[model samples]
Target: MKLVLAIAPDRFRDEELFVPQKAFADAGVETVIASTKTGTCEGMLGGAAEATTTFVEVAPEAYDGIVIAGGIGSQDFLWGNNDLIRLVQTFAKDGKVVAAICLSPVVLARAGVLKGKSATVFNSPASVSEIRRGGATLTDRDVVVDGKVVTANGPFASKAFAASVLSVLSPISP
Candidate 1:
């Protein structure tokens, strides 16, 4: 099965995380939630879900793609996490799709990917800087797909986020 991995920390945006997750599921692509730790991770909305898996920690070549979730937890949990960075880069180098949405597009820049790719972030200063530094053309849309990397604006745009991810998973519409 094509693995679509969603990366998150203890606290990630609920809508941004799940919307794309369910999209992967809808496309029959198996998804696994990877966290820095093994415990149940809390969502930005105030609830939690169990992380069924942890980072490969060995080989990033295992997953077909990686989706990074954005939120306060990204700063708290993933700020200094090098494994996450390595994973994003590994997937990107393999020509695998990498996606990040909301305030998390910084992860893409730090991963050293998304360079010269058109993208979007949540209209935050950090996001703007990261996108520019990465040589990406930023758009003012809810969802922006630059090559294999897809980004969404915020929680309000989950529907478009899911649709975009779905389109990435299966290149054709039925």
Candidate 2:
């Protein structure tokens, strides 16, 4: 399966990007890194990754899932990006797996995809208020999955967040 992983140009939480990426890779999922521009993006903790594509280049239909990595930069760069918001909305409408960790859930909130859904994000006033205002029932859980939408609180929940995403994309039969 293929997935698009979106991050900011800089300061994306290192674990939020790397942990889920490793989980996806271990599950045989192909990930395409996307950002506002094509180049290397530095994580808050000094990790670096190269963005292979720009937001304008992402085609929702080309992948089975979308994951947005969050950090302080996400609040700065991704919150008001119309293209990224539209892309997240498209993924939700398509019934594709959509996951966001840390502060990135605000993008989903801004996309109108979180309406009436249950989700969680890092405990910040802006993040909480925006999510609730978007119509999601904000939860304090480490991870919450409402149908195809998966959300995690912060970096500490990255692994569980990824596992939830994998379960959505590739469910294990009883």
**Could you estimate the TM-score for every candidate?**
0.87, 0.96
User: What are the per-residue Cα lDDT tens digits for candidate 2 across 1-174?
Assistant: 899999999999999999999999999999999999999999999999999999899988788978999999999989998989988989888888889999999999999999999999999999999999899999889999999999999999999999999998953132
Residue-pair clash count for candidate 1: 0
Error of 1 at 8 (Å): 3.5
What's the lDDT for all of these models? 0.74, 0.92
Residue 139, candidate 1: Cα error in Å is 1.5
lDDT of 1 by residue, 72-157 (tens): 77766664578877888888887777888787777787787878888888887767887788777888988898777888777888
Off by over 4 Å in 2: 170-174
Clashing pairs in 1: none
Measured by TM-score, the strongest candidate is 2
Model 1: lDDT equals 0.74
Point out where model 1 deviates above 4 Å. 56-58, 170-174
